[model samples]
Target: MSEQQGRQRVDVTLSINGKSYTRHVEPRRLLADFIRHDVGMKATHIGCEHGVCGVCTVRIDGRTARSCLHFAVALQGHEIETVEGLSADGRLERLQQAFHEEHALQCGFCTPAVLLTAEEFLAENPSPSDSDIRAALSNNLCRCTGYTNIVKAIARASGREGEAASSGTGDAS
Candidate 1:
């Protein structure tokens, strides 16, 4: 067996959702695996081990990505933010509220990733159009939600249908 493929001892610290976790892990342990197993953050789901589905998505240092695609060893000392980190005092964020009000989910499989990605997107854009939302989230695939309510939810979150239609065409501000 390869060195990193089997269980081996390694110590690291991870800042997740604004909390710190110092633990030992195996080299083969995936970031998603570690996030769920060690830190007990269950929101980061594994949809595709190959990184196609965005269900395993999380924000590592403010950029969203497939947690399954990254290794735990690579996350040392880096700030990780799972979908669970976005709330305050157990209440949902504004984007999440928008999602709920707009009925932006079904089956709830891809909801976490969608929400995280949407969170970062809206923070940067804060006002994106439908096409803009689609383009920003093109990599994420949702079998439920039909990408319609999700789109509308983002638009609603931004407070503008016109905002939802704006491309990443201009400078972000």
Candidate 2:
């Protein structure tokens, strides 16, 4: 660790989207900043720097967490997953495709975190009710599309294509 501007800086090595990144950062540097600035992965957006908003959500060791709430130094040697890693073969994941087809995203600020959250939710609950999908995404905040399309997209991705179609009337505005 070295001193920079009276704050201690340390070296951290972590994996993001299957790529290893080694960066020297301040002890107080949030993982969100580290991912965006140090690692050059801009898919992770920061909102409500206080962690209440889920825009900065990312997977730490396969579990969703608020990146803004964690320190970069504490994540040394940990595996991190961002939206950029969702499609390793240059094809959209099921959820991503559904989001596009269902029009789940508008403005797209919260789409990445929402997609990550819904991915984990659907993995754990493959056949979820509309209510269940809404519950799973309650933590994420989206100002566009009214969350109707987002739920439909998640439902569609979970293999409930008919149910997703029946629940919604038209595309979300």
Candidate 3:
């Protein structure tokens, strides 16, 4: 524990996107806040904060987890991957390209989480059915474009776009 301005802080070294970030933070600081404020990455948005919205999703050790549900101090020495890390050099990843071509996002508030989730899901099940995709994305909520295009994007990324064509309501509901 380190003391700063009469406050006790914990120093944690987190590996994010293949880089190491060491910072002194309060013991109770959430990982989402630390990523957004300390590390200065804005892609990890905070939504419901209750682990229900899935807006703050990120890959912890190659598994998708809610950043808002974790504390920075508890994740010391852990591997964290955000949407910013999804791309290499200047080119977007295949899933991101699919999202772009499929017009999967609107308002763009929840796109990052959805992309991260879909990335992990596709890795685990490359040939997922439409219902499997929907079940995987059920935790993430979107207020626009229904879920038609988003599902299509994931399916396209998985080389199975044809299967998702008939699924989804395309309605906000």
Candidate 4:
């Protein structure tokens, strides 16, 4: 560890959004801060730094994790994906488009985490029921939209809206 700006700094090289970044960060620096301040990706929001809010969620080595709970040094060789990487082009991905169509966001603070969670969930399940979508989203707190539109958006994105409704799990009740 070397001293930088009065703190112990460690050299780390990590990939973010398909781009490689090498930086000297404090050992205690949160991954969220590293991504936001060091790597300059602002999509990963920091809320309830203790990892309860889930707003700082990102994909670490193909798994969803709370960036706020991990140190940048711990992710030295890891591959992280922020919301900006989800799009192949400069436009919104299907899930993001679904969110927009469903009006799933209000303040938009929780959108990134919610989108990441939905991406992971859909990747594993592909055709998740409404209950499954709700269960996956239960770990995150959203102060807006009441989760009704969010569920619908996920259902729409998964292409299971009718099945979810037929199963009586997508009513938002």
Regions more than 4 Å wrong, model 4: 1-6, 89-92, 162-173
Encode model 1's per-residue lDDT on 8-74: one tens digit a residue: 7788778888888878887768999999888887878887799987889998888998899898888
In model 1, which runs have C-alpha deviations exceeding 4 angstroms?
Answer: 2-5, 89-92, 161-173
Give per-residue CA lDDT, model 4, range 1-173, as digits (tens).
33445686778888888889889876788899989999888889999999998899999998999999998888867889988888755434888888888788999999999888889998999887777788898878888777878898888988756344344343333
Q: Candidate 2, 157: how far from true, in Å?
A: 0.7
lDDT of 4 at 144: 73
Q: What is the TM-score of each candidate against the true structure?
A: 0.85, 0.89, 0.89, 0.87
Give the alpha carbon lDDT tens digit for every residue of 1-173 in model 3: 33564487778888989899999887888999989999999999999999998999999988999999999888877899998988745334788889899999989999989988888898899998777888889999887768889888888988876455764455323
Report how far off residue 53 is in candidate 3 (Å).
Answer: 0.2
Candidate 1, lDDT over the whole model: 0.78
lDDT of each: 0.78, 0.85, 0.85, 0.83
In model 1, how large is the Cα lDDT of residue 102? 74
Clashing pairs in 4: none
Name the top lDDT candidate: 3
Error of 3 at 60 (Å): 0.7
lDDT (Cα, 0-100) at 117 in candidate 1: 85
Candidate 2 clashing pairs, residues 3+ apart or interchain: none
